[model samples]
Target: MDLDVAQVRAFVRTAEELHFGRAAATLGISQQALSKRIARLESLLRTPLFLRDGRGVSLTGAGQRFLRPARRTLEAADAAVASVTREERPLRVDVWGHLYAPTRTLAQVAGRAGTWVLGHGRDLPSVTDALLDGGVDVAFGRVHPPLRAGLTHRLVRLEPVDAVLGADHPLASEPSLRPDQLSSGVLWAPGPLDRLDFLHRFADRFGVRARTASVNLGLAHFLAGIAEDPRRFALLPADVPLPEVPGLRSVPLVDPTPLYAWSLLWRTGDGHPGLDRLTMACAAEARRSRWLEYDPARDWLPEPPPGSTAQVYPGSTPGGTRADAPAP
Candidate 1:
């Protein structure tokens, strides 16, 4: 009997997420539709794949055995489609954390890279789904932990962060401020603190109280809001071009500078030629600009993936390791 590709895809995604709602959302289908597909696949195989209960869902013994083959089947189907459909299309690249302007880093290397298209993802989960479904070929953002299987990422840059506040603020005159010095002030965030992973982790690690704004108009508006209140402060990449908003001041954060980590993400088995070109450009630019330098004693970064600092490209050294990472 022949297996249905769509049904197998549904099963694979459901196994990965372990939640019908999330799996359906990722697949851009209704939960009922996903359930129907799974049911049909189970009927075809004459075995149960998932044990569902009020608490959650778990893979059955049959599911555990079918998962690997299911993933291979999906990948084979994708490869078959890509062999003809992908030849003339440019690599589709997407990014998240637009507030931080992740494109700035990409812009530096794009001129030297291959032809591609750029898009924006709502958040990490949205971009992750796009990557898994082959909608996007590459993505750039802060790579948080517990990433699903069949995906990989490379640490490309460790950008220094700056603290923005009003010129009239008490600590504004200081040449540089430590993380603890700003603890007494409010940490202004573009959105809810829980949704902004980097900012949330920063505040937690530094013991700073975070407050969210009702809306984010743009960088100028956001900074102006911070400038309006003496107790309000925000964090941004040092390289982000600040609009000349009156009373706006950006001061370097010192005594363990907070570093924003940027990483490139893609599917594990994708063989797009542009992927290599983009990664090579990242490695070259990273080496030229010392983009990956990280000194644990003098810099602060959210926990990174295991062995992420060794190099930016395979068999190539870009020097992000602590031993060779000099202070920024």
Candidate 2:
């Protein structure tokens, strides 16, 4: 059990070369020194590993079995050394989320903490997958899947969403607008598939298939669509600030169907002072009231606006069978 590795190497080299001088040369030792090392190894092992003959040597059955295990022991020892070296490096925490929203908030939180980097995106699934795989530290998203390994989630915000339109548009003049009214006009609703269903149902309600003019995935494109074009409007989530587009206005989307409720997620068992503080700040922002509550619900209005294309109620959204509504 305590045989020296140097002794094992001496035994193997001599076995391969079958000559004292050649084995000594291979080991960078004199022949007498190598012979002495081999002798000590045989004694420790309590058996002659090689039988000396007139011109060469041969291994005992025990020597052959021992050769295989000795080679494996050397390999295992080398790997163990390499693995421990990697453990000495600093911990790398990878954070991920919406490029803009979390940037302002998560940074003010994570920066005060040490050792991490943030990756940004709107693709929730990819971000979540990265988090599960230990590739990302945390994600800000509208939807999160069921909990599994290495993940801990918290509801961050019940993200409010709004539908916007040009102030001069025919529909904007109504106390409440129906989706069918905009059927003939081209639609300029934004973002990807998750939110696109709202516009789809809006079109379906009218019985007229509406043409989507463009898919504006970025914030600037969504705002610019409203500011420049009198005919275009976009529905966006609440976290995004309404741009002060001079001729534009936004209305609460009576979604007919609600989509994502934005939230934040992280790995469990992590200890960081900075993130904990930031989480509290975000909670405060959530606690503060926002725009949608201020808009008068149609039900609460005492008198309906005259010449209205649709009946106005102050407290309620339009609620007939929206046959045109699309599944979220």
Candidate 3:
């Protein structure tokens, strides 16, 4: 009997994610639709591919054996399609974490990275789904782990972070402040602490208290909120251009400065030429601008996935390497 490519694709994604809700989201389909596809595939095979329980979904023995060939089948199909339509479309790239302004780094390499389309994603999960669904070719932002299988990422930059506070705040006059010093004030975030991974992690690590703003309008509005309360402070990358928000001051966070990590992510088997050009451009820019420099003794960074190491740019020494850094 012939197999349906869509049904096979659904199984592969669900097997990779092991969560119907997330797998469905990645496929841009409803959970019910995804379940129906998986059920049809299993029915055709006359065997159960997945073992479902209250805890979660997991691949059965048959599924474990089918996964490898399924992925190969999908890759082959993708390659066949790419051969005919690849050149007809420009590479599509997307970014998340707009509040942190991921474009600041993308703009540095866009000119030399070749023709492409840009899109915005709500966050990493949404972007990852788009990548898996072939909705986009590449993505940039902070990539936190447990990233699903069938994807790969490379650390591109580690931006120095600064503390933003009201000009009249007690520590605002200081040339540089330590992470611990910020414990005295509230850590203001653009959204909920659980949703703002970087800020939430920062607060937990540094013993600083974090509070989310009711609404996130934009940079100016967010910073203005901090300026209104002397006890309020926030963190931003050193290079983000601040709007004309009076009484707002950004001071370097020292005694272990926080470094925001940026990474480029894409499907593992994608062979798009634009992917190579973008990676090369990012590597060159990182080298020319020293974007990956890290001094563990003087800098603070979130821990990377176990066994994962930072991607070293050409001409850079191991001493300069950082752990797989995630984004702000």
Per-residue lDDT over 28-77 for candidate 2, one digit per residue giving the tens place of the 0 to 100 score = 99998998888898898888888788967878887776775665454345
- lDDT (0 to 1) per candidate: 0.81, 0.52, 0.82
Number of colliding residue pairs in each model: 0, 16, 1
* lDDT (Cα, 0-100) at 195 in candidate 3: 78
Which residue runs does candidate 3 get wrong by more than 4 Å?
1-88, 304-328
TM-scores, each model vs. reference: 0.70, 0.44, 0.71
Across 1-328, the per-residue lDDT of candidate 1 in tens digits comes to: 9999999999999998999999999999999999999999999999999999888999999998888777767767876887888654577899988878999999999987789999955588989877876667889888877687878787778899999989888899999999889888888988887778888888888888746664777788788887667899999999998888998888999888998888888888777778888888888887788887665667777774345343333313644321112111
Model 3, span 1-328: residue lDDT tens: 8889999999999997999999999999999999999999999999999999998999999998888678767767877887888643467899998878998899999999888899855688888877876667889998877889878787888889999889889998999999999987888888888877788889999988646564788888888888677899989999998889898888999889898888888888777778878887887788888987766667778773333344433323332222233432
Residue 27 Cα positional deviation in candidate 1, in Å, after optimal superposition: 22
Model 1: CA > 4 A from native: 1-88, 304-328
State model 1's lDDT. Answer: 0.81
By TM-score rank, best first, the candidates go 3, 1, 2
